[model samples]
Target chain A: MSDSRVSSVIQEWAYSSQAHTQTLNPTTTNHAGSTSQLTQMDMIPYSQSQGLVRGGTDDRVTEQMMGLSYLPYTSSSCLSNSSSTGTTNHHQGHPNTQQDFSSFLLPSLRAPVNKRSISKDSAEYRLRRERNNIAVRKSRDKARRRILLTQQRAQHLQEENQKLQMRIGQLTQELDTLKHILSQRHLHGAEEGVAGESNI
Target chain B: MSDSRVSSVIQEWAYSSQAHTQTLNPTTTNHAGSTSQLTQMDMIPYSQSQGLVRGGTDDRVTEQMMGLSYLPYTSSSCLSNSSSTGTTNHHQGHPNTQQDFSSFLLPSLRAPVNKRSISKDSAEYRLRRERNNIAVRKSRDKARRRILLTQQRAQHLQEENQKLQMRIGQLTQELDTLKHILSQRHLHGAEEGVAGESNI
Candidate 1:
């Protein structure tokens, strides 16, 4: 295809993809959404169109939306006209560009439902940056969990130490009493021996 | 004082302490009726002698008598002969020997009530050892407590993370729904726009 023709095709695809994204954004707001209405409407047609666009699910749409927002475009409305058009010719007919586009959209499509978020592709530089933010948040949560566990263990040990000390004190007191009785018994025996000597 | 003098003093004290101790023994199985009564009366004189020898109370006399069993003697009956001979010029004065005597007698005087059984000393030793053991136990308890707390905190964080995930999912769904509605509205607008243009 001619360069101009390829550019037009790319623009048309991008616009349709954007439109589809707008349609899906509300559904992906919650992982548990009633997509039965849309799903029931026409499964085949929707899936077919889904196959055409890189991001078929609403989650992907949000990821991509956030990804798009991170782009250098100061104005959200003018992104396609300025940046999209400028980068169009460079990616045309490039295998790497196609791969990048697929990578950018596939993660959002297949990301764990609980942790749904965008992953960036080489070409989807704007989306890739957004994915980094999510990764950072996950690590911080893990560290906080570790610190909390450490503190609890310390408190438990202190309580146990105190109980053991009380037990030792009680044992010492009993020992002392036993020793006292033994001494008194010895003295009585001595007196009897002396009295026997006096009788002799 | 000289070593021999110290030894003699210790021996004399031990011998005297031992004689008085036999008179005070409570577990005499002697069936001699008059001898038993005489033995009991003799204990008061013996006690006074012990008080003169060490210048201490009955409690101290008892403490020393109990300490004797841990020594080499079999019976308190040998105390009379042992006293005069033990205190001869043999041990006149030695600080180390004196210290030894002091240590042996100190417990009885200082802790008179502790003369229950050999367990009294053992209990004291055990208490010391236990105190050390508690230090170790405390550390372990601390570690365990820390782990429990960590687990609890992690559970709390997990709950929060789950809630946030749920919220994110809901927001995604809402966004998707909104986008779907917008698309329907826009599609309707586009259809109306086309009809109007065709008429014009």
Candidate 2:
């Protein structure tokens, strides 16, 4: 398959996983909750194991080449295909073409291949899921912290506003008292002048 | 008058001035906005001047001793009474008591004493009112600044919240892609395994 097709497949897988996580925790997904449209394709046991081996190896090489180090786990096929590709490469130099044919049957000759591969694929899937879950949790925690900090700052600002209002009140009261004293003195002076004039 | 009565008078003057300030700016008086019930008392001119002189000096001394440096200006009577009291004291110690008495008579002796005193009182009132107006404007400006700051901070917090929400969406999408890839590989492996079994 072309590189673009492989990347598109991986992108589809990530989208599916995000949907699964949302289904697991519906409450938290209220903000950007959207139903995943990707359907689950059923697979036969043997093809599932083989596909796991091929896709895992291909995804890992593609991710590494693309420098996507954040995706910690390689594709499921990487572990199985790497040794097989190495063996095939080594056998390519052999003159005995019949040995190479026998080598191609080696996987079938192993009685426990299906069970072992299936178990391995299951384990890898579980590990990748765990890592994705951790990343989601971390992002959520960070968002929550930011919200809390902002709320605290808003509360502090409100308190400061109230205190300033109180200060204005005190100053207003002081100014009024000063004005009253001045007016009182003026009135008193006027009255005394009138009395003095009447006596004269 | 007793020291207590003098202090009471000063206190009443302070309270009256505070009431006047409240009346001038009715909007900001959230705490003591009730109408002042303190009645204006009539007084002889000599006593009015004496009270002004005493109250002015006492209030300054009290405010200084109390460390109330924020109150920049003294009681209203201070400016007018300070000059009058100085003239009275200088005349009191003169050997020509009769001449000093004539000088005291000079204010009452003048036909325009009432008009001149009224003009002087008006000028002082105008100056005091101007100062009060400036203080009110300053207080209002400070309140406006505080309100503006709070609104800006609230806007900033909302923007931050939006950015964080966007980040969460991005992270969710990334996580979903990773899950989809893992599931796809598992399904592919199963299909290959079933095909192998059917061939066997």
DockQ scores of the candidates: 0.01, 0.01
Q: Per-residue lDDT for B73-148 in model 1, tens only?
A: 1111111111121111211112222222334565433223323432312445445444554465445334333333
Model 2, B1-200: lDDT tens per residue?
22232233332233323221111111212111111111011111223322222332221111112121112111111111111111110001111111112223333332232334422124464454445644654453443333333334544454455565565555555545545654564576567556545655
| Candidate 1 chain A weakest lDDT stretch, 10 residues | A73-82
Model 1 lDDT per residue over A8-119, tens place = 3343334334321211111111111222222221232322322222332331211111111111111111111112212221111211112113225344342233222222
Q: List RMSD in Å for every model shown.
A: 48.6, 49.3
Error of 1 at B88 (Å): 41
- How many backbone overlaps does candidate 2 show? 41
lDDT of 1: 0.32
For model 1, report DockQ. 0.01
C-alpha lDDT of all candidate models, in order: 0.32, 0.30
